[model samples]
Target: MRDRFLTGLIGYPIAHSAAPAMHEAAAAALGVRVHYQLIEVEGAGRDDLRAMLEGIRRLGFAGVNVTFPYKEAVVELLDDLAPDARAIGAVNTIVSDGARLVGHNTDATGFARAIAPLLASAPRGPIALIGAGGVGKAIAFALAGLGVGELRIFDADAARVARLAGQLAGRHPVRGVASIEAALDGATGVVNATPVGMLPSRDSPVPDSLLHPSMWVADAVYTPLWTPLLSAAKAKGAKVLTGRDLAIYAAADAFELFTTMMPSTDVMANAFDAVMAARYSPPA
Candidate 1:
């Protein structure tokens, strides 16, 4: 009999991740005896990563999802990096083949597909993006691939944003701005790629007064599901795309990558919806 397959997500502070439930449901639907684990390697440095890889090999695990600070760090340790992942400078999915670990990025493609329907009929214009970190790089490239006319980038680390702007310059009209106010002015769409509205910080990246009804908003943080930036966008009458969409889409991509099977999206969506409902439901 074939060894039961195992896969999981690796990150620090992964207590709140939905990946375990998502993958477990997919595995059940496929009739596969797959186990999804969340390995928390808090402050896991180079040596910790080496041990984790060895452990995965020892257990004969199929693959793992890399998140947050590990995305970029794991790349250096991988045996191979997919072209798109190399371009984005991040990897969210990894597959281990014996001693070889391959890194790939499905986040950009997944996110692009999730938001495609929303942008189908809207007027294409410049998008102002706040943040130039790992996820930001993926989102920026995804927007370019989706055919955005221009991109205005702003980050607290001005140098990083400028570097990303330079990398994306030829792809589209790229402008690096120092002020958030300048970045948001007359922008067709706004993306909050920063962790500003994430768990610990419930404050909106931009004040509600600054948001316009015509703008479209996308947030990459899903913990709270409806982030302050998204809330402000909804209040301003903007079409809102929550981080949950990205999470679901990325999970679907990972499911396919790990299982090589297309699980029913409707089933997965229903499972995710139920989980979200239970999570946000009021106390009895």
Candidate 2:
């Protein structure tokens, strides 16, 4: 018997997401026929979102990936939340079982797995994280799991940063800083989870002079692969972790959740690299 085709991504402004490509490649490699689409729900009110969910249920989708603004919003619509998702107060992936909607958080696990090996060999020190939004919260929790001693969080929105700090206080020492420069001081690893260096403007969230050689920089923006934050980090001799790495790992996890089959990770990684390189390669 053939398994049902299923899974998709739900978010606004998903035109540049590499999720479809990565998931399609995994499905092809695993000999499963699956379909993953970008269901843009921007400007859609509550009723529209409800309708969309109903349509997905009717279509019998196994699951769907949520992103950005929708991560927190989708939680209210879910029937149950996975332990990790509940802890983080965010849901990046959702599994639909008949009429039950189960929410889960795979972003933190994926981020930690991708960067833990790199940090394992280095000396333990405090981490400086920029952007205190949904992705930032996930990364902060992941950092705690990775054994980070202290986290300095900075966000343009002071209230949001404070909220994130409060949430992480019991698990690890968290400090809410007023400026990015203050947060980066004596930091071992730096992370950018904001949209500053995403696509339209190639600008680093922090000044290059503030970055040191010993710091490790990770950006959460995958599109326009070499984000300004990463570029500056590379120039400063800081170990760089691209957002693409996170996407690859997260997509692999999502693939397993949606298909219940673990595809070749190496194949998926290689395919992701090839696709990204081709897309961003300089024109002749």
**Please, what is the whole-model Cα lDDT of each candidate in the order they appear?**
0.83, 0.84
TM-score of each: 0.94, 0.95
Q: Write the per-residue lDDT of candidate 2 for residues 1-284, one digit (tens) a residue.
A: 45656889888778888887788888887777778889987876667766777777778998899887688777778889988889888889988876988888889988988888778766778788998888888899999887786899999999999898888878888899999889988888899988888777688898989987888999988888899889889998988898977888888887887778886777778777877887888978
CA displacement after TM-score superposition, residue 106 of candidate 2 (Å):
0.9
| Residue 198 local lDDT, model 2 | 76
Candidate 1: stretches off by over 4 Å: 1-3
Q: Which ten residues in a row have the lowest lDDT in candidate 2?
A: 43-52
Global lDDT for candidate 2?
0.84
> Stretches of candidate 2 above 4 Å error?
none
